[model samples]
Target: MRFRRYLDILFVFILFTKTTFAQGNSCTDDSTAGPDDPHSFDKAFDADKGYGYVVYGDLYRFDCCGTVKRWDFSIGDNGKIELQIWRPVDKKGKIFKLIGFNEYTVTNKNRKSGFVTFDVPDKERLSTEEDDVIGWYAPGDSLIEYTDGTSYDGIWKVAHDDNLKVGDSVDFSGGLDQGSRTYGIQATLAPNTAPKFDPMPDKKISMDINVGTTIYTVKVDDADPADVADLKMEMTTKNDFFMFNTQTGDVIVQSTITVPVGGQTVTLDFKVTDHCGAEGTGSLQVQIDYVGDPNTTPTTTKAKTSKTSPKVKTTITDKTTTDVKTTKETKITETSVAPVATDKNTDKNDKTTAKPDLSTDQDPSNGTMSAMTGGSSVDAALIGGIVAGIVGLIIIIVVTVVCVVNKKAKVRPSGKDPEKANNASKDNAKNDAKDKPSPTDKKPPSDSKSTMNGKPHVKDKG
Candidate 1:
């Protein structure tokens, strides 16, 4: 009877052992266990210096939409780190999405090093979903560098399922101790912004020009308010007539531009690049032509001259002879003239006389001229003789008058009768002679007979 009782108790013990083993195996074998399960860490190790508890930090998502075929991260501490993915339920619960529990070991080869890539599991992609969180459980304390090169003491980020677009910011927080955290990280989608050309140049440019001159300036319009002082300008076209300054965007004429047939056009291509490697493009076109040339020839002119012809004159003469009391008819010609030159181009009505011979001779004795002449002339020899006779008679009358006046003057002084006056003169002379004593009678006295009358006369000596 006791043996039968012991066998029955052994059977009950075997069944109870089998039931406990099955329940334990169910918890350990379940790969899609939810976080609410009491034994959720059945596959996880205990928290120790070599292993740490799983930490659910903030959620992370890609800045843009993309498929993450591979992932990499830096290990700040030397230990194994397990990357886990979680998807949110309706309200506040989360479930583990298996990635074969991708885990990596950090050593001297990969400690504080570059990104280490992880192997993705088969038939399962670490895709992004809303309310998804990429988490990490570092078995030890660690640090990570921010985009600004600032190091923060914490566990590094893994992956995110954010829905933000490119160039949008993703701000998150991290902490060395789980419950105490601060917003310290931000990342932006690649290709932050597209470049643009603000304040673009004018579409068409116009200018007026004089020939043989140059256009020395070009316009540049760049609306970027940033520091354009260092912006670069490049002209793609190669033309000898123009040169451009890349530093200043100034276009100058290298030489005088020449116009071609059917006019001409100059095309220029310009590109501006900023310090950020973003670039903008623009173009310019110019048309030019030559109007005309500006030089000509000259001509000549003449001056005028005026001349007047010289004149010739002639005179006629007439004469009558008084020597024999007769008037004679004789042809006489005298031409008083000055030297003159005749011109054939002179007016027909203008009678220009020929030049006369100054060496011609004329008669001097007769008051008549016997020279050859073309016109009729009359001699005035009779009138010349009468004039000479009247002059001589006048001269004789003057002389006779002068002589008679002289004779009268002499007779008046002699008392009107010369003979009687002469006789009276003789009588007066005799009387004077009788009354005058002669010089001979009053002679100087000498010792002679004249002194006998007792009168002494002394001879005078001078």
Candidate 2:
């Protein structure tokens, strides 16, 4: 009987052990599951089939007995998490609507079955951290907490459906995430609004008239797409359009008016408008050409005419007239003085003009003229005076010859005179003898001369 009790006890112990093992190894079913079963299974009977487990809040895994055959979560096979629906829940558990989505993904080497999953209950699901929420509150789309701690601020692209559950695994193409968890939903982007731009008008137009060529330049800061079209320019002279460039805003015209030479000021009007109902009008006063007065001939002029013959004739006539007048005056003066000169000569010969005759006892004719009175008498008297002068001259010549003959006779020596020199000597000797003592009477000489010998003679003479 004791042996039979031992067998029964062994059977009970084995059954208890088996029940403990089965309970320990069984997997819990989760909403976040892969293609495998999503419910718990009998570990003792169907351990080789799929089972459920959870990772994070929205990821799950399925194990075949001891091996995990498949895994998934609200995140995708790329280990990305999807926010099936995220909204702000009030303290009473009511949800508030907002605008974008939040989702993310996780990848690691420890992932079996190519993925990881998790089942998140209502309490385990990520709640919006007040600081994590963004954008305006709305309905059907919003961002929530992600596994990566980031949030999605984009618009909703996909609506919530049966495929998306509280803890169902969802693959998100867009959203925010942290690790294996994600928040918010996918959203489509609104069409981008084209940038608004301001229209620009043409500016700073200038014209250069250098070297007889007119260059026009149009300056512009910028232009809108619509304003860039419909730009035109025209050039005019004297209110007439000579040339124009409509497209490029360049206008060059051949000018009929010559450019002024010095300097001139002109006005240019430019009318500009764009398609956007914008208009600009400008006027420029440009200096153009130079000008001068016309050529003119001198008004004041003079000519000089001259003749040679007439001047010579005038000079000769004046000289001849002067000579004739001088000759006539000279002749008249000479004729007037001739009578007076003759009378003076006759008066000088009159004897009555002289003192009374020295002798009164003279004949009338003789008394009137004496030796110089009558003409014939004067002539005969002159003849007699000349004869007397000749006779006196002859006498003087005879006297002079006689005086000369006598002087010559006196100086001549005569042989019959016995040579006066010898007679003079003998006379002189006799005179000397009469005047002096004879030689015998001469006193005896000094003793030196008395002796007739060769003694020196000495004598005293006065």
lDDT of 1 at 137: 48
Over 264-352, each residue of candidate 1 has an lDDT whose tens digit, in order, gives: 67787777654334466766676654332212112222221222232223221212111111112223323332122211121111121
RMSD of each: 37.1, 48.7
**TM-score per model over all chains:** 0.23, 0.18
Name model 2 segments beyond 4 Å from true. Answer: 1-212, 232-242, 258-263, 292-462
Any idea how many clashes model 1 has? 16
lDDT of 2 by residue, 290-407 (tens): 3222132113222211111100011122132111100000001111221122111011111111111111222245532222212232344343344333433433444445456766
Over 4 Å off, model 1: 1-229, 292-462
Best-fitting candidate, scored by lDDT: 1
Q: Tell me model 2's lDDT, rounded to 2 decimals.
A: 0.31
lDDT of 2 at 277: 27
Worst 10 residues of 2 by lDDT: 324-333
